[model samples]
Target chain A: MTSLWPIERIGFYEGQASAFYNVSAIERDYFEMWYFDNLGAYKSAAHGNLEGVEQGHRKMEAALESIGNKAREIRDISETERKAGIEPEPSGLWQTGAYTDYNREHN
Target chain B: MAAAVIYRIRYIVCLLSMLSLAVHTALANEIPAQGPFTDSECVSCHSDRNPELIRQWRNGPHDPASGVGCSSCHGSLHADANVKARKNQGCTNCHEGPASHSYSKSKHGVLNRIEAHEQDWRKPLKSGNYRAPGSAYCHLHDGDHDDTMSADRGPEVRQWICVGCHSPRYVREQFANGRRQLDIADLKLTEGKQLIASAANSQTKELSKLRQSLIYHRRNVLYGVGHQSPDYQWWHGQPALDGDLIRIRDAIE
Candidate 1:
């Protein structure tokens, strides 16, 4: 019979995959939505609405500043969890993108 | 006199185009001619037949204000709307920009580039169905047809859409943090702007460099924040803005 009390599971934690997955997605969507919204505004300004063009550009900048920090925060938290050896479920979010620094400091 | 003649011709061209569109629409709506959808005929016929599509459109960001109709996105061809939506060509017809570069940088884009055909696209455009939210999912409100762009307004109104995949609390917290960071970046921008204005010599190469630095800061802010791109914000965003401020101050000196 297989022992239910499994010790020293893969990836240092049982839920590591899930926690990483959520963090990966959170960072990614933050970037993706920003891309989508930024383009939408550019298209709007390009099509017309020159009056709001300057403000529109400023708003886009503000959003980037905000999202970049958010992504970093998420990455750091996940890294901390990894260090702590706390695990999540067994799903995965593709750890990609330079913005999220997903590959930073990994063994 | 030559300019006046050109203006006159342009005015006549506009009038004729409007007249042709009006005639085309009138025939489509009144004559009940059965063929490919011409103008607003899809809406006219579907208003009674389907009603839901029309209702969704009426409530969405498009329709009367956007001047976009069924034919605009779905095209005049008698193809399936679901099939048309699986790809982004319909939305991209009008919403073009450099956002693709950001998307391509993402792993999602990289994955799609390699194995997009592996996706079960026939499953329809909805939240739980697709591996990820495509352009239609975001813009069309998960097949709502209302064209509700929740992300445009911000997280307060549309975090529900994200709740499909993420915890609401996590998303809200991220949005709040993002807002705060943006405020801080704006302050940096204000300082840079003042420095640029106060600089004594506007025509000097130093002043020109300052002007160029300000533009870069704006670009960094947008690319950095909008894409959540650490490559931009960490390397080029806050740090670059700090660098720009240094550049501006040096120029003033």
Candidate 2:
């Protein structure tokens, strides 16, 4: 049986939904790269600079990559949910004002 | 010599009599019989006629003093007082001035020359279902209001729409004398100031006092017969007059 979760909501909270959601699909992205990178670290050790500066940079880069890939996945899921006449919960940086800058640059 | 003098005298008398006769004829020639209307002829076409305009005229200045009657502008309807006999010459018969000069320039008069324009014009004039209470329209148009016009004659006469007689330039004159009179005093600036100054120089005052009183008294003039005493005085009249006076002074300098 399919999960009875509500989907494709117009203005749902991003943090509460699945993280793999593309937040910048339609709106002007107002989030900067550093913002997305920092948000993805969540208070984990990966956010710290203990592993040398170069390693820290690499970790920050990886965080950005994860956020971006997760965002695309979320967007695809959203489109699918919408096509099926279900409203998926809003997810990703767009809802939470996280990837706003990144989205604006591309737009 | 005596015979020659007598002949010249007879010739002079004949000339004088001729001039007098012409004047009498001009004044006495009965207005031509017009369309199906007669005296009170408007009643037939305008049935259930309320003579509001006539009543106003009876009580108004035009009754006997101003020498105007309904028949003045609209002409007489001796035979048939229908609309056609009441041709457009009524107003032109007597009124001669810048008004007549300028009316020829106005769009209404210009457009009126076209055939059937009378029918087009009649729409607005007749559609209002308004019949003048008596002949107030005649009185108002002729500026035959009873009371001597003053600067502060309140709104009834102040808000008058004088574009019919005077141009916008002459409109400035009504406010000039500080009295609502549309006569010569308001029509000309020299006359306006002179009249006011003379008033102020009332038997009891010096020139300065006369000037002050003139300023005080002249504050009440109304620019038109309809709308705005305060707004007109402050925004349009006082400022415009003062500005005009300044320009005149500068030109003289």
Candidate 3:
């Protein structure tokens, strides 16, 4: 009778994945800058810049932790809903008349 | 009026807190990472644990005053008690100049293809071949790191390092052969110069110059200096140059 999955859960997971992607992008940039620093040019400034990047990394780690916590909360709530025999509502995109018609035409 | 004053005081306190936080963040970013280990810590631990190595390092040219410590050559990133990480690049990192440049071209450098950063020192000695001396063996022979005495003595000290692989007799023989070569080079240079003087044509002038250069080449002075081999300098180098000059002169005549 009740839906286990929240409509917003997909967006929440997407947001978490995006945060991780951002962290990966930042890490790649940090590594590149670190290699450039090792080449002996802009040595002093590069050191300071690396320190800044490390701080940014810590911030990203905190954000990831926050996202992880949110994911756990969602999981717990979904588990509770599942135990109650509530089925997840179908996605609106899949349930749409246009999607059904497209599938029919492809078939 | 009292409420207004209290509100203003709270605003000022909040502003100060924010300013402090900004300053702290800026300071954190500006500070470089203090390496995991300090020189004093390294010395203190190794002094008793590896007394011999510590003693060698202490006596050697790479004292703390020289701005070179254990980590300067060995690197600080390695785990504690990791001596195998010591590299030749550590020497070249600071000693990059003509002398170091020449060493790279010397027989030792060419044969070993001396990469300062390579961990070849850790490998067991290759049998049946002259394992050309690396920077470590040459400078730190028998744990006599004190180069102050050696520096004053010059190439003689280097000769001591050389004798580890090359016997005194062998060196003497090589020197004798080198002298003979020098004589030959001189005779040719002298004859060439005589021929050039007689003709004085552009072709003869060029030939004379080539002969003179050949004489210089025979001297092997730069090669000796680069190798830090005194025998090579006097017996092989200077005499060879002098001989080449004679040879060119003779050739011209």
Error of 2 at A17 (Å): 70
- RMSD (CA, angstroms), candidate 3: 38.6
Model 1 ranges off by over 4 Å: A1-107, B1-35, B48-69, B144-147, B150-154, B197-240, B243-253
lDDT of 2 by residue, B1-253 (tens): 9999999999999999999999888866544334635545653333334455455556654564577755565455444322322233444466444333334333434444343333422222221222221112222333333422333455345335343334656555434433432221133234224434334233333434434433432332233222223333332333333333222222222
Clashes of each: 9, 51, 37
Between prediction 1 and prediction 2, the one with superior lDDT is: 1
- Tell me the spans in candidate 3 whose CA falls farther than 4 Å from its real position: A1-107, B1-36, B77-86, B114-119, B124-130, B142-144, B148-160, B173-223, B226-253
- Name the docking class for model 2: incorrect
Over the stretch B11-100, how does candidate 1's per-residue lDDT look in tens digits?
999999999999999977764643577657677777887688788788777766788876777667655656676665566576654344
lDDT of 1 by residue, A1-107 (tens): 23876555321121111121223333434443455456657776888976556655677677677777866886897899899998855521122222112213332
lDDT per residue for candidate 3 within B33-114, as digits (tens), equals 4356777877886686678777767766676677787666656644422343324455677877545655666677765564
Please provide TM-scores, in order, for all candidate models, with all chains considered together: 0.48, 0.27, 0.36
Q: How far off is residue B169 in model 2, in Å?
A: 25
TM-score pick, better of 2 and 3: 3
Clash total of candidate 3 = 37
